[model samples]
Target: MNVVILSRQQAVERVGYSLGLDGSGLNGELSPALVGQALRRATSILAPCARYELERSVRQTLQPLGSPGDVVGPMVQDVLESLIVYRDLLEMRSTADEVWASAEVTIRPAAPSFVKREDGSIAVLGTAGDVITPIPEDLPARLVHRGALRLLVPTSAEPLAPRLQEFGLVELSEKAWLRLPRVEPAGNYVEEWHRRLREAPIGNRPEGLLICKPTRRGTLYRDRWNPAEVGETGLFVARRPQRFGANLWCLVDLQPNSTARIVDLFSTGDTLRSCDVAWQIQMALDARAGLAQAFRCRPNGDRSTIDFFSPIPSWAERRLFLVGRRQAGTGCLYSYEMATTAADGERRFLRESLWLVEQN
Candidate 1:
């Protein structure tokens, strides 16, 4: 995989060139040197430009280079030399701007398909064969505190956010939780709770997305999300030739900086159950990956991009330099725990949404 990775100097030059500082493009209204420096320091992480890795990757994969008369040899060589530059231009997260409080709902996916619509919108093809179109426009921002339980692979589904308030999905004033029913017996307390929820007319509303639906699809999760890739949260970046067959997805910390003051290690702690272990392990990883996506990656126009942290807006971005004043890695981990107690107080389930939203 040829991912464009560049050096500090190279990235600085690229932005400056774009802004017309290096005598390229039209001179911009902003200062090129200052803006270039800002972008370099802006919030991103890129891999080191090691000659050995590049040499090995290119030599082994460039089959045409071995040909007697390869016409595209020089072009390929040029690309190899500038791998770092193109990758440095990729912007990872789009919710760096701000945070908004919205109803946090989690639906168990039997099989979910994320299909890219022709209008640059993404639709969720739910396991039930129902299409949930154009996922909420501001979902990433709303998911600042609540992270996803698991990442769902792209199936051909759809989106459009539901106004939970109108549908009674927002049960509490603080932050409500929504999870579709699974295994619980019908008359059981939790099952009854979910049954009542499933009976809600949430999905029928104009603002409804996959927030509610009563249809029970085929196999538990057949043709839905890829079970094999379930729980595997890893992202690798590289410049593919657009012919890479299928897409490889990874999670991103959509956490914003504003939530940090309220939820540090000291805040979300108690004697019984404190911050989750998984969230603790993920803080550093989120910082690392978010920064990497910020500074090192490529954006090919208005493509469908999913927020791995939350299965909401597969965003569309030409360039994402969060309109903010903070440096990279200041984002904090925020978790909202929602618990449901059975009527008899015998059975209960608690789900947590953990995220790292970038701050301004």
Candidate 2:
């Protein structure tokens, strides 16, 4: 239940941030004192991926869950019961206006359900084994990540599997994603995105170079990035601070339904005209986050979306879940990302999916 996605240009979503997208201090309104200062600044930008989220919650419970302060004392009591279960689902969705009050919807800001979908699918598995299906679907379901998120789901995303058999969650593999095709750019590309945001410039990077740590020296993901390519196997990178020049990026372990994937990229040099002006200033910031064009995939499946509320049916259709790995002759890491979710529809936001280190 480590859900941190609060965009709409009042940003907040970082683990290893720097794929260009910044400005957040919560002033976009929605008080509770800015939702307790945006949940204490998203729990301090997810405390450097807390031991890479406790080693992906200990390989989804493959046993031996002790020490390390006894599994961080129940992962800090399931992150305070996932903030009291999203503050009682935002007080029962603001008094059960229980279905976004009747229609023509347009409220946006829906994640209130202890948002957890590190990869989606796996909707419940109790019987003392616990994984109460996708983080607190309500009713005492304490969780963190176990039950092999059912080997990366994709039985059309239902993944039940759980008949109890001591430390289970074995399914090996099965996760194929698709749906990518959206192109509409060329309308003077907004005057070349205001002349490259008026000629971008700022990030400094070069303080002894090795700023890509996290290899507790074991092997398979010690806390990520010891050379994490292959579309960052379930990513988690955080290095976004220097005037974020060139839209610096790296902050996405986010996946709450409108799924996604596209890891690492900050380009400014590495040839190919710095990767075509860093992918034309990220499609001019994905055309001001409404998205229109950006598709160049090869890694399981390609996808893109803005999905203008597909004739609502309780809304939920905007995807871009990618996964890469094509080393061969090297030179292959151009990226893209865009998000927008709906449970009550009317453009719930999530833009700033990044990747582009200009390595041609």
- What TM-score would each prediction reach against the true structure? 0.15, 0.22
lDDT of 1 at 331: 22
Which consecutive 10 residues in model 2 have the weakest lDDT in total? 309-318
lDDT of 1 by residue, 156-250 (tens): 44223233223222222111111112332212422332333344332111111111111122112112233222222222111111122212221
Q: For residues 1-360, could you state the per-residue lDDT of candidate 2 as single tens digits?
A: 698655433332231122111123223322222222232233333322222243233234312322233343344334323232222111111223444232111111212122113345322221111122223232212222221111124345443333211234232222211111222343354344344433444233222111233332222222332433332322233333333122233423323442333233422222112223333333343344444332222222232222211011110111221121112121222222232222112122222222111111
Q: What does the lDDT come to for candidate 2?
A: 0.27
Provide the overall lDDT of each model, using Cα atoms, as 2-decimal numbers: 0.23, 0.27
Candidate 1 clash total?
A: 39
The per-residue C-alpha lDDT of model 1 at residue 197 equals: 35
